[model samples]
Target: MDEVSPEETPSQKVPPWLFRAILTGAVALGGLYVLGWLIAELKMLIVIVLVSFFLSFALEPAVNRMERLGIRRGVGTGIMFLALLAAVGLFLWAIGTVLADQIGDFADDAPGYINDIEDWLEDTFDIEVDAQGLLDEFQEGGAVANLATRLADNLINLGATVLQVLFQILTIALFTFYLVAEGPKLRRNICSLLPAERQRQVLSIWNLAIDKTGGYIYSRLILAVISFLVHWLVFWLVGAPFPVPMAMWVGLISQFVPVIGTYIAGALPVIIGLLDQPSTGLAMLIAIVVYQQVENYLLQPKVTAHTMEIHVTVAFGSVIVGSLLLGAVGAVLALPAAATIQAFLASYLERHEVVQELEDAEAAQHPEREPLGDRLRQMLDRVFTPK
Candidate 1:
């Protein structure tokens, strides 16, 4: 080969260190891409596990109380699960009974309501409206008929969705049982793997997370109960049929679900109220509005202040972010997740130093400048002087 400088040599063209660094970066990026794909594939499993994690916290206090009463952790977990199952069964039974009754009522009164709607549209807008004719058109092949077909298909899909939800609930129960029963052992095992200082830090964080999660759950439960009782009274006063079930639905849904929960919860009662009597629905809507304002301004801050340790805007924003990222499960867990993160940061994150400098007074900084009020007064004196 012709004489070549080191820079022209093949080995020098790609330096060994640079080549290795490039290879390492490519490997890391490839690994991350693979991890993302894997996570996407197991998203449903991740959701189930997250739900289980939340349930573990929700059931933890009950299990701890049982453990304090000298029950084995396993037995405590079992008792807790039994109670939960019984409560769920009772809730389901109540919902089923009320829905069956109301569905019949709705069916019987639907035609009259439809006629009322048609009459109102005609009178208000001076447009001819048809209830029976619309049904006839739907029965015949048309755009409305296509919509009916799609709705029927959706109803069929609803059964599958319900089954999936039941499966998720069962999976969550199993995970929560294990997590509660073996929690101590799991902590010990994890601590055993770390150095003494790290072990202490890890254990402290774990306890903090549990404490925050438990407190949030308890606070939310109290708020939900209060909401249920107050709304139940309001519904009863308004003479809404199925007030008890409606109240329960509103309380639980509004408290557990974030952001739009109040609106969604209120919608059902208002709809029922409207269907039963227009004035009742209007009153129910007004009552809902007033209660929401009171709750937002008063009750929410008081109940959740200590437990959440986050601003109302932060809490609501987190729920929206969580929903966007992971749907309903994310929304439900967002508060606890945020609390845990905040607790960790408070404990371990480096504190920001306070500045020693004092703020400069505007008059001192600019001695010739007169205050706005004095300047305005001087202008007024000049304009309105006895000249």
Candidate 2:
């Protein structure tokens, strides 16, 4: 019987479903590859759109306020852009003027400054440095000539880079203008495609994003103003040249730029002060350090408490992540983005007060002390809300 069955060997067949499954998976994989390629190609476009949307969100509240006062959205958006451009122009003018004058003075007094440096080096460190000789060598070795040549060679690249940057800026500005002007219509169109429940959710999220962005801007502006006033007074007192421009530089850079902003901001004043008087430089440095500590401990917590309410660690982490993803622009966007996400999660998620047991246990572990963050939050809440 075994031999008879063997003699009638059956042919094996592939299942129809198996073939279909293999075909479907191949198609899916092909589709995914094309999708990924498309995304890679459009990455810059995506980033630009995202940035435009962020700017739109930040400007929406002001636009709405203007609308309430009977201004057309388009007009309000245009006004906002003009104001922004004017502010930028003013900042550039201040920076250019200060830098040009300072540089001119430095160049004119270069030999004296070099002699002073040499004297200081000899006096302080018993080290001899022929700065003039070094300068002569640098020039004679054709280093300056090479530098000029390099600059000449790269001039075209620099020009191209500048053009690219300008184009990007204009693209962002155009998109932002449209977004702000047509925000309501955009929202309506988006909601029209969604169900009633989903519409409400989308609208709420949109409004929350706008609030967070606007609040972020407001808080930063207030902090910048305070920083400007404080630094301006110190600079004026120290007889730092171009005190207003320097203070404005410090305020805007320190507030707007993250992480190294303070150091960058302080550099200008420090240099200007040193050029004026050593004692003045030392005093400016001390004042800046003191003000920074005060801001970190007192001012920032109080101001951000009402507006952003984002934890310090979270903000720092967001900035780091953002910088990793998109360099400087990402770093600048990080705060508002983090604030929006944090606010959204806070609103969407359920929360409960800490139990007395947990609090008691924490107190027992750290006897007469509370966390700095918690203390600051509680203190600021009390101060601001003052029952």
TM-score of each: 0.80, 0.84
Worst 10 residues of 1 by lDDT: 354-363
Give the alpha carbon lDDT tens digit for every residue of 1-387 in model 2: 355444533455556688899999999999999998998899788889989988998889999999999999999999999988998999999989999998999899998978998999999999999887898999999999999999998998999999999999999999999999999999999999999999999999999889998888889889999999999999898787888998889889998898889999898888888987999888889988988877888788889888887887998999999999878889989999999999889889999999999999998998887757568768779999957
**For residues 1-387, could you state the per-residue lDDT of candidate 1 as single tens digits?**
898655575754656698889999999999999999999999999988888878887788778888999999999999888987897687678768877887999899889989988899999999897778878877775877788899999998998999998898888888888889999898999999999999999989888778888988888788889888998899899898788888888887788777888889899889878877999999889988888876766677778776666776778888888889899878988988888888888888899765544334644576687645456558868999989
Best candidate according to TM-score: 2
Report every candidate's CA lDDT.
Answer: 0.83, 0.90
Once fitted onto the true fold, the runs of candidate 1 whose alpha carbons sit more than 4 angstroms away are 1-13, 114-160, 356-387
